[model samples]
Target chain A: MRKFFPFFAVLIVFSMLLAACGGSAPTEAAPAAGGEEAAPATQSGSTLQTVMDRGKVICGVNKAVPGFGFLQEDGSYAGFDIDFCKALAAAIFGDPEGRVEYRPLTAKERFTALQTGEIDVLIRNTTWTLTRDTELGANFVATTFYDGQGFIVRKDSGITKLEDLDGATICVGAGTTTELNLADVFAARGISYTPLVFEGADEATGAYEEGRCDSYTTDKSGLVARRVVMADPEAHVILDETISKEPLGPVVRHGDDQWFDIVQWTVYATFTAEEFGITSANVDEIKATTENPSIKKLLGLEGDMGQKLGLSNDWAYNIIKYVGNYAEIYDRNLGPDQPTYIPRGLNSLYTDGGLLYAPPVR
Target chain B: MQGTVPESQEKIPFWRNEHTLQWIAQFTVLAGVLFVFWLLYANMQRQLEMLNLPISFKFLQINASFDIGESLIEYSRSDTYLRAYLVGVLNTIRVAVLGIIFATILGVIVGVARLSNNWLVNKLAAGYIEILRNIPLLVLLIFWYTGFFLKLPDVKEAINVGGTYLSRRGIAFPWPLPTETYATYRWVLWLGVALAVALGYALYRQGKKTGRMPLYGLWSLLLFLVVAGIGIVVLQPYVMDYPHLPDKGFNIIGGKTFSPEFMALLSGLVIYTSAFIAEVVRAGIQSVSKGQVEAARALGLNGFQTLRLVVFPQALRVIVPPMTSQYLNLTKNSSLAVAIGYPDIVHVYGTIINQSGRAVEMTMIMMATYLTFSLSTSAFMNWYNQKIKLVER
Candidate 1:
């Protein structure tokens, strides 16, 4: 027995190591497998059923950008992107409040979080690019905001144009489309600049504020939002030059078509509601009295559109009632009264001479 | 007859056999570990396939389309991801190597000072070591970057000393630029170095044979200087490139520039690592027995002679092992360069992972790269340690 003690000790150590390795595997695999078995209403690859079983939509969002997905002082998430996540929650769970788990992700990890099912949907003010759309295995829904890459310099720096930025150190967020655009635009125009890339937007802006960099570059909307948080907002001026198109939108993993359709129509429902001049206050009255065929279809009164999306008939109504229409979402977050206000130019609906056009619900 | 036979000599069933049990346990554990790994691999593959992002290295061939702030080699956005990865590798190596060199020098000085009889010197060294070693390296790096380097004046109001300019952007100094004749002069320089080495080796051997030791290092340095002087006189190998503020630009053109990020990271690494290394050196020196020092003194050796000849050689045997770990720590800590925007391998790989949604491949590559770096460093250090080990009779 004494001689066998050492052998038993060795066996225990080996088993512990094996347990350490094997333990995490089942925990990871078990949840998905169990969720699949527990929810039989939908197919296996459906994110909708998984989200239903979980009872909350795990939304990947940015926590820094003001009026887009910023975290508030009261520990609640606010802004346009946050509202869209709420809209998604409302569409799925019939209630926007308490149905979302906001996972604040960095620009580098947002897609990975989506691909790995860590988040049900990513509404992180992420841009829709060909590379992101195709290679990242993410399906971009309707463009929520049309933006462009722009630079902001100190008002007194006398840097008015792209050519004037030659040989200047520019601060930018790492792993962002803004970083790639700055590189491409500078290379194209024969401008030489040093990019001090920070891991987060706050760090980049902080560096720029310290005058360590002559300028900071990002999405124009982001610049507008971040500018309000600067020490002296009036001291910095965004350049007039637009470097690249940034059509920001929500994203989801590509394999789940039903989930993709649900997210897409949820965004369109907001657009359709805005186009029809439906407000959250008047949505119930309009649903009761409206005779228009499209309005009836959009409000889920005349058709099985919500059922087609594996949702209740009142899903679109829930979205409007809780999260509001597109215009209301825009006005709530980036309206004239808001500090992060940017005049809605290209983000306005197509009928109002902008790029936002959602296909008809019928 | 059975009772007379020893209980130890009786045959045991295979099921009850301890040897068989041990083997079974070993095989079971091995199989379990392999099965776990296989399960993880299969799960990853299935998930990746479902997402239409198969694990492959083909992303390396794609254009990186991102610009790094500083690189040792010429790189543009048109460069491949592989080239960008190499740039990151080179940047990491540059900081680690420079950090090791500077840290060693500072550490040795501080370590010696810690043991000095001078009260102020000893206390100061102790204070430096205690304060620096207690703080987290990341915080120290951030402090050095934002508090010290970034606090410098902006480029327009740069502090100029002679032809050098110091600003928040960087410190640009006048450096020698290679001319056409530098190619030919380089070979002559190498030849001079080789001749100096040979001469130094021969003199060392002669000194070993004779009772009197010669100044081989000084002689070798003088001979090399003479050769270099002749070469300089015959061929002007380089021209001094002075940095000057362009009338219309924000940056000083010409000469070499060390970005504030690089300086901050290097200084942080050097200072933080030097503290730990100083303790190692102190411990190593203290490990040398007091009796050995007394013996050297009895042999009429001075303090300096006792240290140089008797103490350091013996102390090194104890020092080299811990010192190897310190060097590795510095190398790995260089990855923290990402925090301050130093564009090290980890930072570059992060950007790559974002640009191409190939996180798995990039992470694996990063793991393999760091492993290679650590293994090679340890291998070289082990060789040196072995070389310096006391020879057994």
Candidate 2:
């Protein structure tokens, strides 16, 4: 027992030393504000380099949202957000088809995936909010789809307006802006309602369809998309009132400005191509014949615009050449002919009285 | 010889000594474990700091900014995350406690029935045990939820029995609501409870000394009820609040409600856990020696008395230790409430983690909460087991 005492003391001392080392190591390695500035020098293009080395861009996306990001029967992803991911892959590898791997993530898992470097970019239909931007250590590169919270109820339920929803049970997807917005708007109106929060949109919509809930609430676009797949789409109607602004977009981890720039410019490249009347079908012709300076620079006919973003000069050209412009991507996934078609109201170009305005490439 | 060390001990070097080597090995393992934990902690801290997300519990003070569907306490979107978390804790306790009680009762009955002389009853109990024990709890929970509860008729076509309403929305039943005079009536009720306990203790002691046991429990219950009856005449404590479905509204108001989520979760947990508990109880009963039952029968005791007074007390000694584990499993399995959208601790923690981005802190709190519940339950069970434990002179 006496001899064991010395070993116990040594063990205690060793553990204490380890604790001390662990406690102080983070302070030395991560100097808070100083770390952010110093991070870029050490890890500016790290994500890009990793993606290039791995030969595929790993994208976290939604498998549930129909028009934005949906998993198809053939195991391929096809949607508006997926197109953005493809556009990003095109910008990086000059090929979009085989250069992207999509990881379908829940709303609760999207931010964590970005922070943990599990995915290079998150293209889920995530709304941009102040708390998420500042607290979640995420950077919202650009708003690809401007949506707003809305409610959908059975047409025969007589719930035509928000006031009719008093004392109603509303089904909402958990851990999304839709849940918070439902609570806020209803509470502000002094409308007492029970929010049946489900972990996924599929469950929430299923609950609503089963009459377990009186109404289902989510983004207007999501409501449109989910409604189309219901047992009887014409039996339900989205309410006219838009409850809260939900600017959905792609997000990346903070402190990686180069990656952020790449994703941001990838989005802008699509918008600019649309503004310049360039489609995948017409991009090659435009690139060969256009003498306009901005078009030339955007199409990689002149200058080093893509090089400034740590890419080959043909990056923007590749994105347009493969994934097409914003208009083409939107029309393909959510066009008027599609079952989940949502009219491009705020998603249209600025010249067409919408909010999608891209800054000049030059 | 008294002062001299053993020859083997003398020849052993300190480095090769068993005691020293064992101590060194233990210390090395301990050091290795500590180093690994420290490495993980340091890595997490560094990553969080680099991402500008410092680990802080201050987020608990922020407004939860979300509404829980059903909470025992008065909660709103304006409440703090701490309050929301407490609501979650209370919900978990409610389900766990109720699940433990119901599961034990059903398990004991089924266990006793499994050994019955009737062929049909024994086979039915066996079938129940086999079927429920085989399926996973989460699948059963989802089946009970989506396939059973959610498939109930809509609010408009709700099945109403007496004053209670059952629908896909939930079950709403009449509950007692306190009137203004309830505060004054509560003291009399407490007095009755105290008097009943005192009388029961006195009767128990008298029975022990006289060598003839009395029905102390039944007498105490009767005494309490007589006192309660007299109190009710003098002061009415509560009025029954009957639920009423308004013609146009979606909800059944004015009474207590068991949300479909809670009902499904409780039923799933009880049914799943009762199967294992029934087997434990059956084994415990079987562990009681046959000689004890024969001896009780020879002493002229009835079949019920022999089983209750001789067999059960002995069986309890065997039943308790394993029974504690079943209780713990049921409590832990209640965390699956998240899958069914019950506002349990894990569900609320998920929301909090999303809203605050404090996954580390919230996870710690959730784990601590579950640990506290499990520890408290096992501690109580351990105490009870000690009290009923066999003693020898």
Candidate 3:
């Protein structure tokens, strides 16, 4: 044993050095995109083909957001984002109830999960930003929702706007645009407020409720979702001010253009279907009798856009038939009548005086 | 089989020779490790190339665009990620140092209590060790911040004593505000302290040479405070500001305050780590022979004198080595501050990793930082161990 001691020690050191070199090569080299995303192509299979072969789409989503992607008590996921995932699954499998495996990810883990090919697409409430697109090695397909950061405080706190938050403590979720935006706006306005940051929305909101912080900051849509769950929703009120623009949408890995195009058009198809007045309930009727060329092409009656995307011509029809159009998705989860009661404001179609404009399907 | 009669005289093949086999085995293992490493490197390179994501540290120069909840140094959103990271390192070191000091004192006290003749004190110390030792550190931190601290009274109804206040928001205490004159008088204060310590050392050395007892420690402390008091009176380096509740009293201002996150993390780490350290101290004290204690008593040394001069000095030999490990554990365990948003190194890195997408680089830096801290702590303890080591006659 004495004779081999030195050899064993050397062996252990060598292994450790080897492991360190392997583990940190990417991390040290790329400080911005945590080493997790540094080697995306290291995985064995093409994500697009892998999903097809497995007969399921592995979608990264948020299970915490109320109107976007919430996990239900029955163990089923229900939200606008879930519907979009189902729509993508239907586009591939030609059935709205097609197999989709939902993976819930936190704000920090979403991009890395996509970069490492752990999920085919991330449809969490992710904002499209220049740095995220270029540096994160992930591609944003299209904007599905236009949001803005807002603050919520108990009515008795008397904080009605950004100015009123001066010298007050603001609670925000860490590793999010809301936190960054709060810093920007507060610093710009010369407000001397302390920020209490938490790792999750629940923690941030909890701190706010406990009076540890005077205000809770998040996207306006999220504030509404969080408010509805409060024991006494009437006591708290969301501020009228919008702090920062947040355009949230689905995201896919950067390398595969084909996969990117597929997800992008899946979002656009919903927009076009909504524009053409095609509902899931009325899609079959429109396909049978539509005379308008764009409507016909969108429903795969007059064009081969689906074929170009490596799918059958009936892909859009399947998405609409199974997951519904944009209107159907919105009205189902976040419409004014829902528990969240979020207005379509900027999310409405361009024809309806909103920011959503779909390029002609033809 | 045919060469059995002359095998001793025959030249052996390299593979059959024991000396050559050992070298061959060593080289083979080394080569295999190298090959596996090479494979991993090649795979990562290929993947990065395909993904069009080149590894570069240039992103550290970019604006951090995020704010830390607390920082020791000046920081703004406009600062680079590197600066933000430095601030994070400072915060981490601050907590680690404070935690180590507090944990050691608490650990030693409870350790002695565990061995006390009094039943209640012994049972209480043992119970503390068992309870803190069993629960997970992360759960403890969560419980401390959310379950306990958050349950404190609202900010408007803060419990105030003198000028300080305690509320769910945080604990506020009086703070000193230094003006322009502080810079000139600070040096005088430092000089006074140094002179006092040097004078104390001289007295200690003189007493050692002669047979006199000077009580150097007590005198030195008094001398230091006297010199500092003179400097304060002459220069007026700073003004003390008392914390108070404003009219609305929503939050405490114009004072030094410990953020709820920082308090929870520090308490959880100090409390949880003290339990393990208490066990080490107990074992160390027990290792001193019973004969030594009885011998000291027979020499007319009282119980306190026997403990301080005989038991503790000898017990330190065994304690220092393990105490080093406990200090390191407390420092490393501080990474759990990220879970509660305490803005420690790990928490800051998590935000940077998400913002900059440099997960690999942040992880490497974090590992290097912890390693440096552990080594530095071990080196200091080892030096102390050498000073107290048994010198053979």
Off by over 4 Å in 2: A1-37, B1-13
TM-score of each: 0.92, 0.93, 0.90
Q: Write the per-residue lDDT of candidate 2 for residues B1-393, one digit (tens) a residue.
A: 323567665566767566767778787767767786867777788788778888999999999999999899999999999999999999999999999999999999999989888999999999999999999999999999999999998888889899999999899999989888899888889999999999999999999999888879999999999998898888888899999878879888878899999999999999999999999999999999999999999999999888889999999999999999999999999999988889998888888888888888898898898899889989999999999998877
Local accuracy by lDDT, each model: 0.89, 0.90, 0.85
Question: First chain of model 1: TM-score?
Answer: 0.90
lDDT accuracy of residue A317 in candidate 3: 96
Better of 2 and 3 by DockQ: 2
TM-score of chain B of 1: 0.93
lDDT, candidate 2, A215-238, per-residue tens: 999999999989988999999999
Q: State the interface C-alpha RMSD of candidate 1.
A: 3.4
How good is model 2 by TM-score? 0.93
Candidate 1 lDDT over residue span A51-139, tens digit each: 88889999999999999999989999999999999999999888778999999998888988988879999999899999999998899
**Candidate 1 stretches greater than 4 Å from native:** A1-46, B1-13, B16-21, B211-222
Candidate 2 interface RMSD to the true structure:
3.9
Q: Alpha carbon lDDT of residue A211, candidate 3?
A: 82
Give the per-prediction TM-score of chain B. Answer: 0.93, 0.95, 0.90
lDDT of 1 at B344: 97
